[model samples]
Target: MSITSAINLFRQLTVDESQVAHQGQPHVVNETCLDLLLIEMVQVLRTSVAETSFAVPHGGLPPSDSLELPQSSESTTARSNEEQERATELLYYKVERVGFRIGQRLAERYAKDRPRFTDTLDIVKFICKDIWIKLFHKQVDNLKTNHRGVYILQDNKFRWLLRMSGSEGVAHATQQAAPYLWFPCGVIRGILANLGVDSTVSVKETNLPQCAFQIKINRAV
Candidate 1:
């Protein structure tokens, strides 16, 4: 669906009398604002991890003025590699946590008026239609499942990645954009959790604006 169409739908959805009285009129946010916010959030988290990882001790001299013996190049490279991995892990945890909470609240609000879902597939369809439209302005392009608790949701034009590109080519851009997917993964997980489904959500993005989320439900014996 077009963004304008989605905004119109949102307007209709937000007209609950109680909500209006309690929260006032729902505010419309520019799509670009959310995009920019996500970009800036990732940057800030990365910067925070870098600063924390390399922070100097209060009583110790700065790197340039330190009198401590220098480590070998190999040791330095290994430490750098370790720090980079740690930073990436930390970034994913922080971003996903934020999205998870958002998804939980969104599911609670949107699913309240809907019929009770009958099965795991019913919940997945709800996500593909209602929740996806609410967040991405469109329904999922496709959904596939094996009847054994695994589902794959494909979006041909994922809104978040629509404007992302790099001069370094598609592969490079895809690599850089991978981190952003963590948030949506958390979002899907949160949605499922709130609906009483246990699952894990992962993403695969080999091309621009096209991505697939894999949901693996954990059914009890």
Candidate 2:
């Protein structure tokens, strides 16, 4: 079965968090945003992915001649702002762990479909196409390498980011969105790790819903 199908099944069979908690120690096995605060935090993080900052501002104020001034929610209290910032970090580590698990399982599953690879490039290609398609239902839009153990994979429509709604200014939107992308980032890292590739993985968003994962191989065994 495809990874996506497995995840969907997990979501379907999973009990509500409150119910699960009442039974015993709750373990999150599905990708569901449970907390209202996390929902907002995800929105903000998705916005930040689109823009550099949390809020964009008008030069001064919109001119009276303007038909309708765009609304912005840039101004926030210090404590709330700090809380969101901290939450964003927490979201990164949380999703990273989940993504890592997904990647490891996915790699193991995909490996059964093909012959053993002779080089790291083959595994990287699998991630760009096979693994990506399983997770996002689409292949990487672009792939590049420097021929020195550095590979770059770009997805024009990153699935997770596409689910997020756009916020006000570009800066704030991008910053908000940036944190949540860590899940996918961790997915890439985990996949490589399971393949016996020691690498440093990083992600960058050039635009909303489009991001790149860069992998620098440290050692392959």
- Candidate 2's residue-wise lDDT over 90-165, tens digit each? 5566556655766676676667658888898998999988777655557899999999999999988876666565
RMSD of each: 6.1, 12.5
Clashing pairs in 1: none
CA RMSD (A), model 2? 12.5
Worst 10 residues of 2 by lDDT: 52-61
Q: What's the lDDT for residue 78 in model 2?
A: 55
- What would the per-residue lDDT of candidate 1 be over residues 81-181, giving only the tens digit for each residue? 76688778888887777667667767888889888989999999999998887777789999999999999999999988999999999989999998888
lDDT of 1: 0.78
